[model samples]
Target: MSDAKLQSVLSSLSQVARQLEAVPSGRPAPDASCVKLNTNENPFPLPTIIMQSAIAALERQYLYPEDDNISLREAAANAYGVSNDQVIAGNGSSELLGLIYRAFLAPGDSVAMMSPGFSFNRKLAMSQGAQFLEIGWGEAHSLPIEQLLSGPAKDAKFILLANPNNPTGTFVPVADIERLLAQSDRLIVLDEAYVDFAPDNGLRLIDHYSNLLVLRTFSKSYAAAGVRVGFGFGHPEIIGRLRNIQNVFNMNVIGHAVGISVLAHRAAYAENHKHIKHERQRVTLALLQLGFSVIPSHANFLLAHVPAEQDGSWWQAALERQKILVAFFPDKGLQNHIRISIGTKEQMDAFLAAARDISGSLKMPSARRWAASGSASALRGR
Candidate 1:
């Protein structure tokens, strides 16, 4: 516990350990009375069958879980029309992403991703001692295809792409993905975390490209995040390697049962997603009418650029006071924007009402600071 010993231990720590900062602790779970919109949790409820299955699973907890999640893998394969060997289950899509780095990344190996991407992609890469490459988002908030196809990017082990990308919720079309595929031989990880809310998925292109890996979760669309189950579809070769780093019992019994139930009851989940998509559009339109240039989204959220008259920091605080929570990015470019998770129509109505009520007296973050942010001008211009 002495300073000298502490310094030595710190020096020996991995780069990821040194770079990783603790998350600002907040409430363990959402306040029961709060309109929780900060995290992109599905505001819908799981079917009664899932609940019953979880309770039933309690009796089996005395036994070891079915290791390697074979049933769930086969179910995912059936859902995606792929062979069973081409799939593997994880505690979450996040752990699968970690498995990629643990399995493939050597000291200098690199993973390419977009600026303002899922932050965990960069964190996971660095933590695994791999280099992380970032290309800026292009016009219309599209992926910078040219940069990704450039010679430098070709050397990366893979590119982490979130179709219906987080925060922005912009999707890269199948044609666009094909363009990337044709130009580069590197592996492409299409993280379709929000694809359930989108028009198309990357799974259709799997037949054409041997280098594609598509990951999906039971969290966002299926409303089973608490279960922490996720899976990936890829060429058997790549999936086999990911399997090597995976723990035998990565997916628990409850997660296995819940995942199977969700796959079987896809229609019920779809119906709820349809409602979320509608709410997304409604909120987007309402924000636009209020002078915010809301980005077009294919996911269950909206990235609305704050008006020149109000700052996201201010709106975030104001909303918090009103028992509403939403995600805010304070980095140079994202400072003036707010990302709102689409909630039930009633929750959204309250949000819109709060915006209108607070508009008159809301004091925004400083204009000078906004002017200093390159993201500010670029996003506003869009």
Candidate 2:
């Protein structure tokens, strides 16, 4: 098409859509041999019963999945101790987050989230022509209740808080969350994607606060990232509105079957959860010993400040050279930090070995030159 025709066609798009450029196709996925510790995924296999359920579901490939995910929602309701009407199932909690943005945010409205939180919300808000406000966490990464209540966030359509927050892996106390819920009239969307790895959760607050919506996913803790099962629990009215706008047959048969089966046998993954926590601690200590400052993590990942000699990207690139993949954030205040998802013992061991090798190579040249110049001898004599 001519530029004139393309311009005319583009003019027909909404202002928001017109303002947003088409996303570029990114690079191909990493090599299979690379140790992937970038995205926080549970590197474990599904229990035998759950695998059997997924195989059974494949046999029904010709049939449509349950409408509105009724059976799966019922299973989640029973498992989480909520009424069926108060639940809404989605392909993933990410889908539910999109629904919340659609249902609550109009053009020119605003939403607030705890800063250094999930960065995806900014894109979601922009797609709706809504303002995205980022509120910083208080000292020690605690909830800044007064700031959230009295700051510009006071007028936001809703507040988004991720317990055991992403990128930082810092968890806020449930009592502090309850305090905020009690004072705020705005809808509070609590993303608990990593809660199973944390000590406490805010699910109980849903009963008392009509404004609280808790989101959970089977992707992280349940080792079903490929299956894409997630849920939202809130007041029946809120859930109903989200469900009304959700896509028809949003999830497939395998997702539905695996979701129900997992809920029924959640206890089966106790060892999986325990192993991640163990690895998280082990990695944290190892990073500290290597001259990286690691924040105490409650989630299945750790955020570490790289050594003073190099930035996070440098470390990330060096690790990639060793075929170990980890996450690096370029956002302000995060440029010096890298996040690593806790994987199995073998993966963590490989990552640690790579990190140590990188650290050693960095120090070797300086040590060699200084020693050759007799600087070390002079310092020792002094």
Candidate 3:
């Protein structure tokens, strides 16, 4: 193929086709023997009911899944007090994100998103031939509520807000979002992927705001990442529109059955959820005491900003040398941070031990940043 011919062929491709790239870090699954905290996956075993249900569904694999998403959808609706019409299911939250772009974003339309957030959102916008206006947060890691309500972001067709956001693991409060909604007309996408571990969530606000759409996934909390179940809630009109664009058979037989089983017996998993919350507290304190600039997180991960003097890449390389993996970012805003997922207490203890060994110091760094700056308490007295 001549260079000009190849260039022409590429130019003929759709914007999405031309811009799509391989997934960065590609979902962070660590080795089984490795104390895996790289992915924000539930470190516990699947509930017995979910296990039995998925296994039983194996017999039905000979046939296509019933488009009957009823049981799972209804379980989610009942959990959030919405009617089934107000809900839609997807292969994962990523698919639902694409569906939202498909429904609302015209080619070249703009979106508003934050830097150091779920970077996947930026890629999603690019894939849909949409542009994004970014609002970057500093070390303080405050939500850009005032900025989002300002002129720069007011005209976007939609906005992607990841609460208990990814990578940075910071949160925008529910009341703050309510205030933003009153001032803005753009569709607000509240990605609550990690909200299961947070103190508050967006499930209850869907009934109040016509433009708000909240997305959830079984990947992180339900211990069903392998089953690929994700869903969205909103005003019926928006959900109905997403339904029109979604594949009727988007979910598979085994995954459908598994999702139904998981949501139906959600209470059974509460203990693991509580354990993660507790461990997150312990991990944050450990990081803080070590002089790592930790952003207090409400998600299943913590974003520990390595001091500029210490070098994040070096720390990551050191951990990898010890066969422990974590999510590392080369993006400028997050280049100095590594996202540590909340794992079993044993796994967390292993991580702290590895981190200490890597540091090679008997005395840890003082909380110079947190104390002198008056930012906030780590976990002590909170």
Candidate 4:
């Protein structure tokens, strides 16, 4: 190929490279050196049984993983009380999101998602040359079901709703979801990646709504994010379409083995879920006691609104200096807020101490900025 021709092809990737480069490298390391609260991973280690199963798969390193990953699929199906044909596993929930977009979205086809939501959905839609419609979910971060149900864009090709949405940790009620499902003719991709931490799950609604597709990951509650195992449940026909576009061997042998083992021994994962939920509530109350406005969350993370004048730049830097890391987004709607993932109680105590210290050091000018910015209204509860 001529040099000009190669340059023309590579030019399209420049935007992608810039986007990736723009991601902040503020996360704490996972080793003993860092407090590590940036990523929403489980602080606890995987159960002994899962570790054993993964080790056993090591003995069969020479062989390729099963093409169908039937055993893993069966386990997931049973866990969700669905037929095996309805379950489709992937490297992680992130991969499954990409697969669904590629399988269903065509150039110019529109995908509607809530704004200030997970950044992945927007990026994925754009990558496929699809029109991404981001409607701002109200300050509470709940889906604008009424607007979506009656809007001109109701017929969009796909709608991705994150139950107990990431970062904000807000969720739409089941009744609201039912309304959306009843009115939506297009596919509704309900991302339940953090559903295990929510008090209620959307799995029961799957059989009732053929247009609904629920995606889940073993990362949070199962402590398997590193293993990269995730799955989706939907109508068998939709599952078939996804399978057609999927890689032949999406789940590796060890991932499949560990996934199955984790599902088989649910007690440990269940206990972890309970512990995280309890901690989430405790942390929410503690933040509130500290005078920070917190969005009520049903997920593993809490989005607490900090003072805008508090020098978010300095606040984040100070936390890092104290070895406490949390997530900060640039969206104006989330600028004064920090998303903290729930870890052990001891970890949370340390995080609280860091926040207290930082709050004490913030100048009055910063406090005035926060007051002028309507921080209270931004985090008003439902």
Tens-place lDDT digits, model 4, residues 1-382: 9999966866767554434434578895455666777779988988998899999998987899988778899999997799999989989889899999899988678888877789878788877777888777864565687778767458678888888788778887877888888877878888998887776778888899999999999888788989999999999999888988899888788898989998889787777888898999888888887677888888889988875454344556667768898887877777778888899989999999988765654433655645643353312211
lDDT of each: 0.82, 0.92, 0.81, 0.81
- Order the candidates by TM-score, highest first: 2, 1, 3, 4
Scored by lDDT, model 4 comes in at: 0.81
Greater-TM-score candidate between 1 and 4? 1
The sequence of per-residue lDDT tens digits that candidate 1 reaches over residues 216-289 is 88788888888898888888899998997788788778988888888887887767888998999889888888
lDDT of 2 by residue, 70-95 (tens): 99999999999999999999998899
lDDT of 4 at 359: 62
What is candidate 1's CA lDDT for residue 249? 83
In candidate 2, which residue ranges exceed 4 Å CA deviation?
Answer: 366-382
Question: Which is better, 2 or 3, measured by TM-score?
Answer: 2
- Give candidate 4 misplaced runs (Cα > 4 Å): 1-6, 11-32, 138-141, 311-313, 363-382
Find the 10 residues in a row with the least total lDDT in model 2. 373-382
RMSD of each: 5.2, 4.8, 7.0, 5.6
Against the true structure, what is each candidate's TM-score?
0.90, 0.95, 0.87, 0.87
| For model 4, the run of ten residues with the poorest summed lDDT | 373-382
Candidate 1 ranges with C-alpha deviation above 4 Å: 14-16, 21-30, 363-382
Q: What is the lDDT of residue 81 in candidate 4?
A: 91
Residue 303 error for model 4, in Å? 0.3
Candidate 3, 278: how far from true, in Å? Answer: 1.4
So what's the TM-score on candidate 4? 0.87
